[model samples]
Target: MPRIACLHTFDSNAAVFEEALRATGLAGVSLQHTVRADLLAAAEREGRLTSDIAEETVAVLRGLSAQADAVLLTCSTLGPAAEAAAPDSPVPVLRVDAALAAEAVKAGGRVVVLCAVETTVEPTRHLFEAAARATGAAVSVEVVPQAWAAFKAGDPERYRELVARAAGAAKAAGATRVALAQASMAGAAALLPETERPLTSPTVGLAAAVAASRG
Candidate 1:
């Protein structure tokens, strides 16, 4: 079985990936998880991803690459670090949101990218805009108000509900595609009706990582 090293900024994300793996029918792949909440905490404290934080994230990604067939970075805030580390890594280092952004841009129209946290807004916007550049897809990002608070308060039910509402509203407002910008927000996709369901990262990112592992 291929070994996938998953680097997550939140401990809660590990379970999100586990569930996503099963949903993607890649449960047979071996997953090695490393959770480093402090990495995101430092970024949140600084109000941005500092140079030192990026370096430390790269170091972690490089280290994980050595032990697994592929490395997947599951935090959107730290996603740029994965791109920085990928060229030097022996194995493919995949950024979860990158895959999500790519898929969102493929529809070639108005894409509304939803993020729960303030810290993720800019990074998520940049990721999707970069992905949209080539395809001429118009990308816009919106932060789901108060959704992150519910997530931090350990009320996943409320978090998903809020996120789902934001997505549904965006779709009703004329968004051609709605993309959930974080792996943690994946559950919100299930909460929305099928017609309004948003595209999410975890499952798509895991499948891309597994395919990369094979090569």
Candidate 2:
């Protein structure tokens, strides 16, 4: 079995990947998780990803790379660092939102990226915009602070409810495709209707990571 090491910014995200792995039915794939909540806390405090923070994330990935077939960074805010470290790592370092962005842009229309955390908004917007550049898809990012607050307050049901509402509003406003920018927000996608369900990082990202590991 190919082993994919997952780097997460939240302890809850470990379960997100676990559920995603099971849902994908990638039974042959194995996962190793490393959660460093401080990385995200630091970024949130700084209001942006700092050079030092990126370096710290890279150091973690470098260590994980030695033991796993691939490393997957499951935080959208730290995605750029994963892209930066990919070239130097022994194994592929995949950003969780990258595959989701690609898939959203593939729809070739107005795509809205919904982020619960403020720090994730810009990185996710840029990611989807870059993915849409060649495809002519329009990309927009919206940050749902209330949902983030709910999540931080340990009210997960309220958090998912808020996220789902925001997604529905985006769709009603003419978003042809919607992408939830964080792995933690993946549960909200389930609350949406099957036809309007938004693209989320965990399922797509894990599948992409596993594929990269095999290759």
Over the full model, what C-alpha lDDT does candidate 2 score relative to the true structure?
A: 0.92
Could you give candidate 2's per-residue lDDT for residues 134-203 as a string of tens digits?
Answer: 8999998999769999999999999999999999999998999988998999899889889888888899
Off by over 4 Å in 2: none
Mind giving the per-residue lDDT tens digits that candidate 1 earns over 61-82? 9999999999999999988899
Count of backbone clashes for each model? 0, 0
Indicate which candidate wins on lDDT.
Answer: 1
If candidate 1 were superposed on the true structure by all CA atoms, what would the RMSD be? Answer: 0.9
Candidate 2 — worst ten consecutive residues by lDDT sum? 120-129
What residue runs in model 1 are displaced by over 4 Å at the alpha carbon? Answer: none
